[model samples]
Target: MGKAIELNQVDTIYEGEKIPSLKNITLHVDKGEFIAVIGPNGAGKTTLLETIMGLLESKRGEVKVLGKQLNGNGSNIRKLVGYVPQEYSIDDLTPFLVSDVVLMGRYGKIGLLKPITKNDKTVAKKMMEYLGISELSNRPIGKLSGGQAQKVMIARSLAKEPEIILMDEPFSNLDFEARREVSEKLTHLHKTKNMTFVIVIHDIASIPKVCNRVIVMDSGKIVADGKKEDILKPELLEMGYKGIAC
Candidate 1:
């Protein structure tokens, strides 16, 4: 596999904090690989994702994506990447439909002052269909359940046609069946689309089903990196995540 993303000795410090959120973090992701970043709370998982997305500045080291340097702004880099946040906040009473939110994914490519074209609408509709949410396209985003809303978010991300997709705790609020369905859908997409995926997940059990590689972080550092069956051993799980591997 060819390298899709690389971080070398990356470090970041939030305002007014003496300690850095990330310390000397280095990793490389291959193209079309499904990688899971797993860690306990305050382990800098969010910070790492933000750094890759160019939402936060790196105080030290370099981050390269798609063979190009990520200079913090990352506007050009972002064009090839899609992000689905952990939570979706919208007013229940708002009139915006699910399709409307999905269409927003095309805005970055469409540019300002240009109206959404037929091709953009077609793409958004196709993404919705791909996610099995075509029936909910006309529903209000705020009225959807947690799982439904998450599906919409995933659809929106896919509509961007990005080479790399980053998801932050997408199944955190979902029920058991919903979680399984979403995981399977994500796995299917990754395999069929040949896209690189970097997901931040808290559950150890889900990692084996969703990711090919597992990265364990603790105290703002990567403690272990290997295949799921290798790194998810009982001892490593207890030591790094302080939880059962289940």
Candidate 2:
């Protein structure tokens, strides 16, 4: 299997910060792998995703996506990556509808100045239908509830038909039933579309059943990476949480 993502000795430090947010991170993700990155707060999970997506520049070492370096080709590379951030704020009066927001995902492929094609609208509507949010198409994005907004974001990302999807706390706003529903949808997509996913999550129980790998991070470093069955064990997880080398 080809590598979908690679990070070699990567260190990312925020401006004016004394320490790196990510330290000496060396990792590889194979194409079509569903991975769950689990850790407590400040574990650098989000930093790793941003670095992989080329949103944050690394102070040292190399980051690659789809066998290409993320340095100079970030714009082109990002079009193939779909990212759902942990938090997105929307004003109540924001005029864009859910369908419009979802269609925005095609902007990279459609070109910023061009009109939206029929195919683009079809893809957007299909994504909404797949996500079970078709009824929300005409609703104002700003007026949706938190879970609804999150579903819209998921639909938007899916509309891009991206090769890789990176989600940070995607189910944070969802209730138990909704989270399960979304999880099943993601699993189905992973199986049918062969899309790679790296999800940052706080709750281990919420990790999707389709996730085959788990990465544990602490104090800005990856302490363990292995099969889901091995890494999700209580003893191993406790060790990771306690900062013991796994």
Q: lDDT value for candidate 1?
A: 0.83
- Give the alpha carbon lDDT tens digit for every residue of 1-246 in model 2: 899999999999998999999999999999999999998899999999999988899999999899989856477668889988897999999999999999998886566788999999999999999989999999999999999999999988888899899999999999878888889888888999899999998877778888899999999999999998888788546755422111
Candidate with best lDDT: 2
TM-score of model 1 (CA atoms) = 0.89
Assess every candidate by TM-score. Answer: 0.89, 0.93
Clashing pairs in 2: none
Off by over 4 Å in 2: 235-246
Report, for every candidate in turn, its global Cα lDDT versus the true structure. Answer: 0.83, 0.90
